[model samples]
Target: MTRLALSALLATLALIGVATPASAHTDLLSSDPANGASVPQRPTRLTLTFTEPVPAESATVTLTGPDGAAWPTGEITADGATLTVPLAGSASPAGPYTVSWTVESLDGDFVDGTFAFTLTAPATQQPPVATTPAPPPAVTSADAAPTTTSPSAGSTATLDAPPTTGTSAPAATSGDGDDGGVPLWVWILVVAVLSVIGIAVGVGLNRRAKRGAEPAE
Candidate 1:
């Protein structure tokens, strides 16, 4: 083979060797209620299946009802292929609910996400339940960032995440304040939306220019 071909083959082989196997420590393969699934009946228990065996320790499942209160339940358990927990029958009212969970792999990798569903809805009126959270590895990576923080050191980002406003936003009418006080986040969102629109317009104009440069067919 030519020297260039030989080098390319070696590089490809190295890349294949460096690729990690697909044995992820843990990931939710499925759920009984299914994330964002709607059902007429309230589930008696919450069942979660993972891609691989996850550790029993430090695993938490939250079933929050439409009332914004925590659903009371027994301790969560990890079976051979699934983690199961009793649903809070007491407060599982007839409305939409969210089940968020945080789990740790035996390797200490963490994952977290939320799914919503509804009870007492008509058979055809079930709200859209997401089959799963956005995705596994992505959610896992987001969860890992919060834990990697060192308590001994200061964390500006942690504190910055919370809203900076000292008071709740008033009705955004003309009478709110002298200059019509607007929330900082609202202004930021407006700027962001404008920026996106501006970029999209620029891209469209550039594409039009490029197309116009082409000769007639």
Candidate 2:
């Protein structure tokens, strides 16, 4: 009877866990091109902002243009909520440029999104680093203008099908469940099952003690 109780308890726990929901870190925010800023030329770098700080080397941001090409020079560099990417050349002929990014939130869940900005005109030259001419005011992209970004033919960011948003859903993982990733339902189920086991053990021991005291047999 005690064993049956334990088994039933375990089964009940599994069902409860299934009924509950799970979520991932969300797509919180960004800060590149201010969402709707106009640029006269393409800048040498692209930057993105997030609600939480991301790892310096763990985040990736891609910039593509209207002609279906990639513009990012290298990997992104992170500092707090900021992630920056350098441009390969100046920028291609302008229109709208798309900046898509994937970042690992402080909670360790990856979230991604794509946003775009319009460029008015070509930049004559890339911006100089801190070493030169007071560094071109830093107001906007001055060198490359009237440019746009689009997905290249073989770019991974390009969607053959439609893109699925990275909402609060938890993605299945391959590691042992303890990736600090036990779901809320998983934890609750574990606790309930343990409690039932404790109760059954207590009741079974009490019944055994009572039976041992029988008068004749």
Q: Give lDDT per model, in order.
A: 0.75, 0.73
TM-scores, all models, native as reference? 0.47, 0.43
In the range 53-102, model 2's lDDT, one tens digit per residue, is 67867677787887878775776787777888877865468688888788
Residue 56 displacement in candidate 1 (angstroms):
1.8
lDDT string for model 1 (95-114, tens) is: 88888888887666788777
Q: How accurate is candidate 2 locally (lDDT)?
A: 0.73
Best by lDDT: 1
**Highest TM-score against the true fold, candidate:** 1
TM-score of candidate 2 on Cα atoms, chains taken together: 0.43
